[model samples]
Target: MLRVGVLVSGGGTNLQAILDAMDQGKITNAEVAAVISNNPGAYALERARNHGIPAECISPKDFPDRASFNEALVAKVDSYDLDLVVLAGFLVKIPEAMIAKYRNKIINIHPSLIPSFCGVGYYGLKVHEAALARGVKLTGATVHFVDEGMDSGPILLQKAVEVKPGDTPELLQRRVMEEAEWVILPRAIDMIANGQI
Candidate 1:
C-alpha cells in the first residue's frame, strides 16, 4: 500500500474528499496512514479519529522554539513511515529540513491554478478574493509537488472553474473547491499510487 500522511490546519474539507475517495475505492493502492494538524481544534483530527486513523496535533506553539517545532513536525511525519505526505489546506510553511528530506515525496493543493493568485499571502479565501478583485473569468486549483518556495513547485494537475457574476469570495472558493480541488487531488494521489504519475 502507498501509505499517506496528511497535514491540515482547518475544516479539512479536502481531507474529507480524500477519505471519501478512498472509501469509495477510487484510490485502491493507497491508505491514509495518519492525519496531523497544527490546530488542536481542527475537524480533520476528528475525521481521522472517526475513521480510526492515527491523528495528532503538533502545533508550533507547543514547542519552545520554531526550530524545535519544526524538528518535532519532521519526527512526527517520519514516525508514520509514509510514502507520501499530502498538505491538504495545511497552513504551515514546511521546514527546510523536511522539504529537503521529503523532496518530491511531498505534494500540496493550492487554491488557485498557480502562477496567478498563488505564492505567499494567497491562501484560503484570499485567493478567491484576489481573483474576484482582478475580475478573472476563470480561476481554479492546482495539485503540485512541494518545493522550498510557496506554490512554486512543478505542477501535477490543474482544473479550472468558472467565475460567476455576483459571486462572493466565499461562494467562489466553494465552487473552486467542489469543481477542481476535490476532483484533481484524489486523481493525483491515485496516479502516484499506481505509478502513473
Candidate 2:
C-alpha cells in the first residue's frame, strides 16, 4: 500500500475529498498515514482526528527561523515513512531540501489550470479572483508534481469548471473546488497510488 502524508493549511476540503474517496474505494492501494498542517487551528487536523488518522501541527511560527522550521517539517514528514506527500491547500512553501528528498513523490492540487492563474502570488481564492477579474470563461484545477519552483511542476491531471456570468471570486472558488478540485485531486492520488502515474 502507498502510505501518504497530507499537508494542509486550511479547512481541508480537498483533504476531505481525498478521505472520502478512500472511504468509498475510489482510491485503492493507498492509505493516508498522516496529516500535517502549519496552522494549529486548521480544521484539517480535526478531520484527521475524526478519521483516526495521525495528525500534527508543525508551524513556522513555532520555530525560531525558517531554516529551523524547515528542518523540523522535514523531520516530521520523514517520521511517517511516507511513500507520497500531498499538498492539499498547503500554503507554505516547501523547503528545497524536502523537495529534493521527495522529488517526484510529492504532488500538489492547484486551484486553477496551471500555467494560467498559477505560480507565485496565486493561491486559494486569489486564483479565482484573478480569473474573475480577467473575465475568463473557463477556469479549472490541476494536480501536479511539486518541484523547487512555484507551481511549475509537471501537470498530472486537469478538469475545467465554467466561470459563470456575474460570478464573484468566492462563488467561482467554490464551483472550481466542487467541480474540479474535489474531483481530480482524488483521481490523481488514486493514479499515483496504483502506480498508474
Candidate 3:
C-alpha cells in the first residue's frame, strides 16, 4: 500500500475528497499518512484530525526565507517516508531542491487546464478570472507531476467543467473544484499508486 502525504494552504476540499475516496474503498492500496499545511488555521488540518490522520502546521514565517522554509518542509515530508506527496490548494511554490528530491513522486492539482490559465501568478480565483476574461467556453483542472517550474510537469489526469453563461470567477472556481479538481486529484493519486501514470 502507498502512504501519501498531503500539503495544503486553505480549505482542503481536495483532501476531503481523497479521504472520502479512501472511505468508499475506491483507493484500496493507499492510506493518508499525514497532512501538513503552511496555514495553521487551514481547515484541511481539521479534516485530517477528524480522520485521525497526523496533521502538522509548518509556518513559513518561522524560517527566514524560501530556501530555509522549503528545507524544513522537505525534511518533515521526507520524515514521513511517504510514497507520494499531493499538493491540494497549497499556495506556496515548492522549492527546486524539494522537487529534485521528490521528482515525479510529487504531484499537484491546478485550478485550470495547464498551459491555459497557469504559471507563476495564476492560482485560486485568479485563474478563473483569467478564463472568464478570455470568455472561454470550457475550463477545468489538471493533475501533474511537480517539477522545478510552476505547473510545468507531466500531465496525469484532466477533467473539464463548462463555463456557464454570466458566471463569476467565484462561481467558476467552485464548480471547477467540485467537477474537476476534486474528481481528478484522487484519480491521479490512485493511478500513481497503481503505477498507471
Candidate 4:
C-alpha cells in the first residue's frame, strides 16, 4: 500500500472526498497516513481525527522565517514516510526545497481549470469571483503536479462546470467543488498510487 500525506488549511471538503473514496474502495492502493494543517483550528484536522488519521498543526509563526517553516513542514511530512503528498485547500506557497524533495510526487487541486483564473492571488473564492466577473460560460477544476511556480505544474486532470446565469461566487465555488474538485482529486490520487501516472 502507498502511504499518502494530505496538506490542508480550510474546511477540507476535498480531503473529505478523498477519504470517502477510500472508505468506498474507489482508491485501493493508497491510504491517508497523515494530515497536516497550518491553521490550528482548521476543520480538516478535526475531520482527520474523526477518521482516526494522524493529524498535526504546525504554525508558520512558530518559526523565524519561511525557510525554517518549510523545513519544519518537510520534517513533519517526512515523519510519515509518505509516498505521495496531496495539497487539498492548502493555501501556503510550498518552498522550493520541498518542491525539490517531492518533485512530481506532490499534487494539488486548483479551483479553476488552471492557466485560467489560477496562479498568484487566485485561490478559494477569489478564483470563482474572477471567473464570474469575466463572465466565462464555464469554469471548473484542475488537478496538477505541484512545482515551484504558482499552480504552473503539469496538468493531470480537468473537469468543467457550467458557470450558470447570475451565479454568485459562493454558488459557483460550491458547484465547482461538488461537480469538479470533489471528483477529480481522488481519481488523480488513485492514478498516482496505482502507478498509472
Candidate 5:
C-alpha cells in the first residue's frame, strides 16, 4: 500500500473525506500513515486521532526559521516512509528546501482554480468571498502538485461549483467543499495511483 501523510491547519473536513474514502476502499493501495499540523489546536488532529492514525504538531512559532521548521517537518514526513503527502487545508507555505525534497510527491487542494483567485493570503472563506465578489458564475477547487511557488503547481484535477445569483459566501463554500471532498480529491489520488499524473 502507498503510505500517505496529511498536513492540515484547520478543521479536518477534507482529511475526514480522505479517511472515509480510504475506509470505503475508494482509494486503492493507499493508507494514511500519519497526520501533521502546524496548529496544535487544529481539529484535523482530532480527526486523525479518531482514526488511530499518529498525529503530531510542529508549530512554526517554535522553530527559529522556516528552514529549521521545514527540516523537522520533512523528517516527520520521511519517518512515515510516505509515498505521498497531501495538504488538506494546510495554511502555511512550506519552505523551498522541503518542496525540493518532496517535489512531485506533494499534493495540495486549493479552494479555487489556479492562476485565478489563489496565491499567498488566499484560503478558506476568503477564497469563496473573492469568487462571489468577482461575480463568477462558477467556482470550485483545484487539486495540484505542490511546487515552491505558492499554489502555482501543475494541476491534477478540478471540480466546479455553480455560483448562484443570490449565493452567500457560506453557501458557496459549502458547495465547493462538497465537490472537493467527494470528487476532486478522490480523482486526483486515483490518478496518481494509476500513474496517470
Candidate 6:
C-alpha cells in the first residue's frame, strides 16, 4: 500500500474527501497513515482521530528555527512511513530542506487555479476574493507538486468552475471546493499511484 501523510491547518474537508475516496476504493493503493497539524486546535486532527488515524501536532514555535521545525516535521512524517505528503490547508511556508527531502513526494491543493491568486498571503477566502475582483469568468482549484517556490510546482491536475454573475466569495468557494475534493485531488492521487505523474 502507498502510505500517505496529510498536513492541515484548518477544517479537514479535503481530508474527509480523501477518507471517503479511500473507503469507496476510488484510490486503489493508498492509505492515509497520519495527519499532522501545526495548530493543536485544528479540527483536521479531530477528524483524523474520529477516523482512527494517528494524528500529531508539531508547532514551529516549539523549534528554534524554520529548519529545526521542518526537521521535526520530516521526522514525524518519516515515522509514519509516508510515501506521499498532502498539504490540504497547511499555512506554513515549508522550509527548503523539507522540500529537498520530500521533493516531488509532496503535493498541495490550492484554492485558486494558481499563478493567478496564489503565492504568499493568498489563501482561503482571500484567493476567491481576488478572483472575483478580477472579474474572472472562470476559477477553480489546482493540485500541484510542492517545490521551493510558492505554488510554482508542476501542475498535476486542475478543475475549472464557471464564475457566476453576482457570485459571492462564499458561493464560489463552495463550488470550487466541491470540484477540488471530488475530482482534482483524486485524479492527482491516481496519477501518482499509476506513475503517470
| C-alpha lDDT of candidate 4 relative to the true structure | 0.94
Residues 103-196 of candidate 3: C-alpha lDDT, one tens digit per residue: 7899999988788999989999999999999999999999999898889999988899999998999999999999998789888888878888
Task: Go through the candidates in order and give each one's C-alpha lDDT.
Answer: 0.95, 0.95, 0.92, 0.94, 0.87, 0.88
> Where does candidate 5 stray beyond 4 Å?
none
Report the C-alpha displacement of residue 164, candidate 4, in angstroms.
Answer: 0.5
Cα lDDT over the full model 2: 0.95
Give the C-alpha lDDT of model 1: 0.95
Candidate 1 lDDT trough over 10 residues, lowest sum: 111-120
Residue 66 lDDT in model 3?
A: 77
Q: What is the C-alpha RMSD of each candidate to the true structure, in Å?
A: 0.5, 0.6, 0.9, 0.7, 1.2, 1.2
lDDT string, candidate 4, 122-153, tens digits: 99989999998898998899999999899999
Candidate 1 lDDT tens digits, 19-97: 9999999987999999999999999999999999999999999999999999999999999999999999999999989
Report the number of backbone clashes for model 3: 0
Error of 4 at 15 (Å): 0.7
Better of 2 and 6 by TM-score: 2
Q: Model 3, stretches more than 4 Å misplaced?
A: none
lDDT of 5 by residue, 9-88 (tens): 99999888888887887787778899999999999999999999999999989999888898888888888888899999
Give me the displacement of residue 91 in model 4, in angstroms. 0.8
Model 1 per-residue lDDT at 113: 80
- The residue pairs found clashing in candidate 5 are none
Name the regions of candidate 1 deviating beyond 4 angstroms: none
Error of 3 at 144 (Å): 0.5
